[model samples]
Target: MTVLASSAPVLEVSALTRAFGGLVAVNVIDLAVHSGEIVGLLGPNGSGKTTALNLISGVLRPDSGTIRFAGQAINGMPAHRIARLGLARTFQLVRVLKGMSCAENVKAGLVFHRPPLSRGEIDESVDRLLRHVGLSDRGGLPAAGLTYIDCKRLELARALALKPRLLLLDEWLAGLNPSELLIGIELIRSLKEEGLSILLVEHVMDAIRSLCDRCVVMNSGRRIAEGRPDEVLADPAVIEAYLGVSPGVSTDA
Candidate 1:
């Protein structure tokens, strides 16, 4: 069920700001992800895109402003608490338990967010999630044994095991080959079709253009543009901020 679809956004940030000593990493940014939508958080390196995701996921607390999730103010909540609250995420650099089997990794997610499950139910969930991320055959292998792309898939499965209402993906598609990228895009699309809300910080323009219903662009810790992926990516200001090209105008020269 797509709960809390119209009454409020699945995720909302208003005037969100965060700073580290002398530098401001996130500066009064505002954005929202509605239910059943995938919103691309796009920016170049060091554009505070990841930092913004960190704040939303409770890895870092905002210095000011507010974060609301499912109509509740979630400012300053701890990361684990946030995850248990039906928001889950994967990191830019995939985090996995190298010592654990892929199935164990997924089981960790289930038990973390859902501890009352019977052993049979946990096993069923782990198998299903691994299959969902195309790792059904590899579930018995060590997480360290998987290739980089496969590890990414494993991380996604673990996050899905949380059954999050809103999922934050921080550059989860950064290291895939062309074929793998296509598969990754389709996986994410299938999740959205299943009624998941996502905020994706992705560098792959093809994925962004294909998957995102809306895009929010950031430059130097502030939002520079927001709109349809194609339109926002084409905006002169966004182009300038992302590509360092001057917004040129032709005149009698």
Candidate 2:
């Protein structure tokens, strides 16, 4: 797994802004991810975390600002083109096709690489990913029949199929129970070991503190604090915005 340490920035966002009619979804946000790092993006509900991911993934165009991937300008590129550039993301809601099997759902991710690989190679890669996610035996199951956790895993498997240099995940653990959260956290940790850069938007404070090297806190579509997880979590403004209490405030006081 790869962890960031003052290395070259793999993904850069410069003054990114997005709006929906009268609403400013993402407001002039600037952020970056290095070659090997796990960076956490956190905020309360309706914060711009998801909007930022969509802009970065090209799922939605930015009203202003720029995005660069691997040092190349990619602001206006289509989502598929961005995927081809080694950037992939999983949605907060698993978006697998109900009619497809688990293996087929993941196979869709492999499509970006183009000109199909030899059947042997394809099978080996798919099987390995399935096994890695502990779903080898379930690969043939219809996606609609899989449990919610399995659907999340399938989403992850599909994202990994792109061989992404950076993975953007939106609340991957949302709706999961304790056991499922643990598995997701462990999987992410393992991916970091494999040198995959990750930008995760999560509401789970424990997961962020344990798994992230740094945290970026956003409020009302703008970044308010960023640093080591503990430091950011302790910021007064961050606590006020999300935790509903200012840092150092005591109920007795």
Candidate 3:
């Protein structure tokens, strides 16, 4: 878990910016995620966290900036191209293929990896990913039949099927009840323990505090703070801008 500052980051962004017509959604922001680390992207709604993820995952091209993943440049690349090159992501809203069974959704992701799995291999891998995401019993169900939280799990299972080098998770823990939230946190933590690099955008402070190795804060399309989770959460500006609390108040209280 000791990140070598001198080592190249698994994901690196420099002066990343994006705009929509008259509005600047992301300012010149710089970020990096090293191997085996989870970096939390924190901000209020509309603060450009999702915009940044879109840009990073190639869902939307940045107006300006550079994105390097696994030592390759990726700004302006198509989302499928990015996924093929070892990057995968989940959306802020879960995106399972509604017409497909849970296993089929994962199978769709499985076919993309090199050395394509045989039919049996694909089936076995799909089952493993389903079990990993706590959906082993539901693999035969249609995605449209899934509950909200189950949809989130199915989406995660599909993303994992890509075997990505870095995963961009946009609010993956949102909308869970307390017990489900704890399981969600632990699921992400287990992913980190497996040495997967992650950039997580989350509003759930508990998940961010428990799962992130470092945190990045943004406001009005610009990065405002970056540091350990506790350090950034304790920052006066971040508390006011994101947590909606006056300084000196504990968010956990």
Candidate 4:
């Protein structure tokens, strides 16, 4: 796969902050994902990783900040509008249309495309996407009947149906078994190889190590560090934030 050499970022967030009542969920976070880059967003629970994704994806409006995608300011834009611009995301929890067949669920995501696909084209695209996500034979099955891993796969197919330039993956690797985790990692790498920029929010340390070109560490709704994965993971602030102890201190002390 050929990587684009464009200097402009595919997604950019500056001083992004969001608050719910008196609680600040995300605070002054600046992030960027350039074309063909897979960046990991890592932090402990309640550290605002998912919240940051929501703000960037238009699920929640930022209280203060600017979000630019493909050179257009997208802050406060409706979710569907942002999606039409090639920014798509998967939820931390697998969400599928329980009543719809797997293929139908994927077809629903295509509703927003500009040129409007014909019936035959839509069917062909749906089949190809289901096959891509390893759900080729399950297209006729109701989505509710899929196992947890299959449900995740279905969500991925649906996201791909949008033909996004940038994909935000929130905890897509959370509940997979060892083998399933390996498959998930390979799938992400393949997407990256195809020139899809990704912002990944994941708890699996091994997957993060294998998939991320750069890592951003967050804690208490703030960005603590951003650098190469090995460097960020070894930073004193990241270690203390994740382990709740100083780097040199013994936990048993």
Best by TM-score: 4
Best-to-worst TM-score order: 4, 2, 1, 3
Clashes of each: 0, 9, 0, 0
For candidate 2, what is the TM-score?
A: 0.95
Q: Among all windows of ten consecutive residues in candidate 2, which has the lowest summed lDDT?
A: 1-10
Q: Write the per-residue lDDT of candidate 2 for residues 1-253, one digit (tens) a residue.
A: 2444557898999999998989998999998998778999988888899999999999999989999999999997899999998999999888888899888887888887555677787777788888888798777899999889888888889899888999999999888899888888999999988889999999888799888988888998999999999998888998899767787778683
Instruction: Summarize candidate 4's per-residue lDDT along 93-145 as a digit string, tens digits.
Output: 88999999999999998886556899999999999999898898888999999
Q: Could you tell me which 10 consecutive residues in candidate 1 have the lowest summed lDDT?
A: 1-10
lDDT of each: 0.90, 0.88, 0.91, 0.91
Q: Give residue 73's lDDT in candidate 1 (0 to 100).
A: 90
Candidate 4 global TM-score: 0.97
Cα distance off (Å), candidate 2, residue 1:
6.7
Clashing pairs in 1: none
**What value does the lDDT take at residue 157 in candidate 3?**
88
For 10-90, candidate 1 gives per-residue lDDT tens digits of 998999999999889899999999988999998889989999999999999999999999988998999888888889999
* Cα misplacement distance, residue 14 of candidate 1 (Å): 0.6
* Number of the candidate with higher lDDT, 1 or 3: 3
Ranking by lDDT: 4, 3, 1, 2
